[model samples]
Target: MKRLIVLLQVFLIGACLNKELTNDQELQKPIIQSPWVENPDEIGHDFYPRPQMKRANWENLNGFWDYAILPKGEKLPTLFDGQIRVPFAVESDLSGVLRKVGENQELWYRRSLSLNSLQDGKRFLLHFGGVDWESEVFVNGKSIGVHRGGYDPFSFDITPFIISDEDQELCIRVWDPSDQGPQPRGKQVNIPNSIWYTPVTGIWQTVWLEEVPEFYISSLKNTPDFDKKTIEVLAIISSESVADKVVVKALDEGMLVAETAVTPGEKAELKIQNPKQWSPKDPFLYDIEISLMQGDQELDKVYSYAALRKISQEVDENGIQRMMLNGEFLFQYGPLDQGWWPDGLYTAPNEEAMLFDILKTKEMGFNMIRKHVKVEPAQWYYHCDRLGMLVWQDMPNGDHGNVWEHRLGIVGKATDKQRSQESEQIYLNEWKAIIDANYNFPSIVVWVPFNEAWGQFNTKEVTEWTIDYDKTRLVNSASGGNFIMDGSKITGHMIDLHSYPEAVMPDPNIFGKDNILVLGEFGGLGLPIAGHTWQNEDNWGYQSFTDKEDLANRYKQLIDKLEELIQKGLSAAVYTQTTDVEIEVNGLMTYDRKVIKLDRDWLRSLHQKLYDLEIQINQ
Candidate 1:
């Protein structure tokens, strides 16, 4: 992978610990797999990776693959080092190769392909759910394509390189600088310490193959108009000629609600009468089907889904700006979910384990989740979409050279980090790809381009550009720093402030005049369990507690303060986290999700009060 001069922030909160980690300490780590992980030695994730738009004629190639760690300039391995599990990072325990491949080395993976289902007059597409940083693909030793940006999915057409009749071979080479280079690596470091965790290199998501016709549907972009009761779909087609059209259908429980036909490049608007609006209380998704057609023949058909939900803002009767969900004010409260796993650093052990966090968050009376500075797999968003959970997606933070020094409950204006032209373009490209990849998911209500001003530059331009690109959702330009509340330079849809250990917000009289006021992060009440932690000793939180009762009481106090702030026009709030990660022990649950540090019922009761304000949002 290419390298850039991205330096570290001079100051990182929390004193440095674990500076002298040894191989013995790594050996002593217990196997802390999730409860939903079926097998520890053998990983299993057979579910379809891409759920937003799916086709039946696909094969999951996620079992075992030969892997080798070689020098950065070394050629593709002729002699494999060993077998590493596909989709799991090489450093993960489940991969059977808990070894770090640093910037000096590159990770190579190759596996035999099965073409038993190969069909005549069909095209084959090789797909990788995600490969960290950068990756190059090869089919039968013929170079196919190279893909950058690990957080987004990519694929290549292998029909040209496929040796159809005989056996096939698929190979990939991945190089990730992790924290050593300038990339959007969130909470990852070459050496794990404090809040930063171990580096994740190589394929961290699923890999598969798909079969399609020559003129197949490449992608679908859906936009819903709740006011007009209509859903518009643009089915992009990959074809040799431009004589094809597409038919779009919106269905309710297998029955048709609306249907329309338009050219493949044009948007097909389907109008629905009396549409059922989706909300946190009742998330109703309409099934959709798009078919590529000639004059009288249907060539390809794909299935997808969408929701008729609206995200907006309005001035309240008290002359304060409030975030509106479905034309009503609804409190958005949830944990700052860092999508990490004890066993799987970047990838989940399986689909069930991935869904477990979202399920428990809902059960604990959370309506929204601020996915902290990291993007999750599409399946995670799909779960939230189906389960009626709101999401505020973040562009994973990296290239940290700016000043983000907000002490506990302190506030100030920070300087923007100056970035190289390459670094800036990298950020822009990945940000757009991340949005395009997950645009169809109804769960995502807001998009955060920067958090705590990490690598934040040209904020006004970035925010305005994002707003112009996708008007369907709100954008938080900077989540936690450089407050622009005087209405002079209000950049994005919201103005956020960072508070710690206690609930606090900007003055609604000032901030709420131009922007939606929110507590971007607060209430890091921590109670680390005895045996469930990444490290045995020196585990920490913003405010550490020893007992469950004390933590619960402290949390209640914070929630009480939050309720008062909500009354004063705090539009939304995000707690510190959902679970403890690595050595930072500020979570309601332990790292492995085995123990709940606080009473779930009490949390639910406390959270319900925030939602059950005077302005009730209808289901």
Candidate 2:
């Protein structure tokens, strides 16, 4: 405890943390919030932000918070400008303060905490789901700590700051440079233009508080061994402090399937009689309860869930490499899901609205989603895990200098940028944090480090390092970006290419011999409906259609081509996008999500063929 307090005092940090055209200036166009936001407090974001490891005794600190914008290096302000909604960025309409905090400015937030009937002998922790760029925290005017990453969650033990159960003031100071710096601000820019979006500043995710005993389970790392019919869990204790032992129990519908116990840092293995493997067709999940115990006394208990699945690569009889999920060749097809909201920017107005996109994707008969170049809140991935969506999670790319804008597929130039030491370190730190944060999710099958050469550096080294770091998931070094070929083989696991308007695959004869061939991005068929679009003017897609019928017909033609590519060893393909973002109208659905441009039955029927298309090989 003394060491923890000492380290918290000197917390000075300097760490940090993609598509399409058209820009709408000063979007003053009578933007209506999603019906989901109509009763923002009624139903939203109350779900456990970290679903994998959930405790019963935790406070949800996601309501109105007093905020002020101050100059950089300025002292804490005694008076705030106004109230801004917590867990929403100030630049977002949902935040109630549509403003931008640039590099020269700092965003300050304050809220009072009145702790009553506090649990005895328990430590209090204040957690922020996520804050943009850099953030500093203060409790009752005493500086606690600071964090720099914009996407990953962080917390501080505020038990020491709680003044005898009185009203305690909690404040946070945040500064984000957005695209102005080398941080990983994916698709965010100060000046909005073709493919860049309005800046998101300050806290954009839920803020909460949790209490625990002195020695409790902080995190659980669960790994399911599909072949061995067992699950291994390692419970990490708070502050690396030791508990006597931790017990892991696996249950199926409240029936205990297996149970085991081991020391806190040691792996506890539970052998199952018969494991029901998780797949897109049947995403069976086993309920997990992790408990920390000292002798006969249980100190902490956290509820979690895990799925038994395996991802591997196999060479077909035709000598084409394929992605094997659970030892089966399942051709993956989904959209380039850019998880953005017109009103919420990087966030959705509510939880149901957030799940709507994923639910619609499943309804549209898609089995996978390439989460394009941006990290979402944990709940978003939790939905995918439960709904059985295979995910290709991209590490949000940034520090752009060698951005391959025009050099597209087949005849495109593959370029690698030389980043400064600080920039490279920033990328590495944030990339690791993102992976570690989302590592436990069973839905994510692939980790994409770079997309389309945006801030791509040391491809071979980074790709190899990611592979070494997490051997469970496949690494796409530079998705649809530079295919840095080492002799004949590319640096990444998949040979990915980007082509607009039509689906295309890498030549199986050339690169498919070793790498899994995939169409990383294609099909930007746009049919913007009036009143549902972000802006009435300048809304564009790669190919614009006047009517839904024409769009469907064109999409059918693309699917026909994809069927041919599937036979030519294409293992997976990602459509241009799930919905229109800002003025770029290339989406299956409009930006507002009120109108789904494609007919559900028609699109699903057309998509089912791609999934059923068997790779015919000369026997």
Candidate 3:
């Protein structure tokens, strides 16, 4: 038996080496590669996707998978076109197959898994962090299940379908109509241009398998209350038999600060003495551990973390409404971050590449980012929580039939789009799932439901529901887009307006007393570097500039105007973007992230002027 085990180990090592060589030779070279793309081991996103609920036993199913693109409604083909990298969209250069799977086609993926990794009497869960549009799963040619939403995570229990002695065959079918369908696809279009980008089809995130007990912890919701100095935790457990009890622990730098035992599915309130508050300047998080118990035996355990903070709006000493962080008024200013990549499309080339953007944003003297019309992997938010950056997350937009009047000078209310019942339900379901999945991240301070007028419908009802569902965060019903008016007054918590080429805010005299005025978007100044642009000819910006000195000077002028608006009760502002996307050259950085379009020190000094005004407000 010892000799047999030695022989098996050798064979497995040889197989992995052979597979690596094949992957390198079979995949297509990317047109433009990031710094981390040279190494084969760093090709896919291999980190643990879910950080809020983490366990010890899991396997990453990223690397290479056999892929074939065939006509729609066709049966699975026995022969594959080639090997494509998992988690990168098929149309992306990193996928090793830069081929478009259009509305009339379907993308297929196949991989083989060994069941020897599974322990006896343990259930195996297959998880897909994200798959675009529609997906169907199959094991050993038997159908498992189907999922429709594109931006949310989905999982399946595949223990029963596995054969104990033989290797398991896993296959997936994905169909994404992109902009042609009513599904929520943000900025993806068939023909990429100006603001629209290349469509991402099939899996674009981490795919993995996890081992769990028959009864295990499914999910967790953490809400922090600074006034009460307590953290509320709600753990959802799955089981056939009722769990005897649940143990929750709060640790500060590895020392136990608070702990409690409660019944399964019950809310547990853990109190701490003089808890550290979380803010952009000092982000302190308390680690948490939860375990499902039966008598004295522990069935399962998961790790998480939370912060103690509060966000609200109130009247200041100057009699102007201001956005407050913790308890004091703060002037929020940041870029409109559209999370996209040149090589990987929807997915970043590597974890380091993803962190570079957030770090650079901070280095540029910004404290927050409005994640414009897109949701990112949980790890992105995790970095924000640890590194201390506030986030205003937007729901992905889709299904547009109404005409969006870009009434730049007009201030009256805009009409909401009339969507069918099916479209409305789809939008609501996905929005709720997104909010629930990301509720624990402390960096997220605002939930933005609509952008401009692109799929806006039933604005009043949706905004009210979002506020009711999660009272901890503020809700921006529409960002610089449409305004659902309650008679003459605008709905939602903030009055947002969009202006191009410069900063502008709503007239404080008309909307100041009731709502916090904000310049949701402005200053899309364009400066396209020769080699860094997506295209040389058609690239454009809201206002075009030539040299770095000119861009810096123009941006400073915009900041000067913004300071004046702040004096007029502008509570927050979001600049055009953090990075240039596609043919739009209005970003602080170029598309490839290789160049900063303007002077960094000069820009930081200019931004300091905005932050200085916040100090004056407090004084």
Q: Which stretches of candidate 1 lie over 4 Å from their true place?
A: 1-31, 38-42, 116-120, 240-243, 405-413, 484-487, 616-619
What does candidate 2's lDDT look like per residue over 330-446, in tens digits? Answer: 889999998888778888888889999999999999999999878999999999999999999998878998957434335356567999999999899989988888988999999
For candidate 2, the TM-score is: 0.93
lDDT score, residue 505, model 1? 84
Give each model's whole-structure lDDT. 0.83, 0.85, 0.86
lDDT of candidate 1 over 275-307, digit per residue (tens): 999999999999999988888788898999999
TM-score of 1: 0.93
Rank by lDDT (best first): 3, 2, 1
lDDT-best of 1 and 2: 2
lDDT value, residue 599 of candidate 1? 76
Best candidate, lDDT-wise?
3
- Candidate 2 weakest lDDT stretch, 10 residues: 14-23
TM-scores for all candidates: the values are 0.93, 0.93, 0.93
Model 3 TM-score (2 dp): 0.93
Model 3 worst lDDT window (10 residues): 22-31
Q: In model 3, what are the clashing residue pairs, if there are any? A: none
By TM-score rank, best first, the candidates go 1, 2, 3
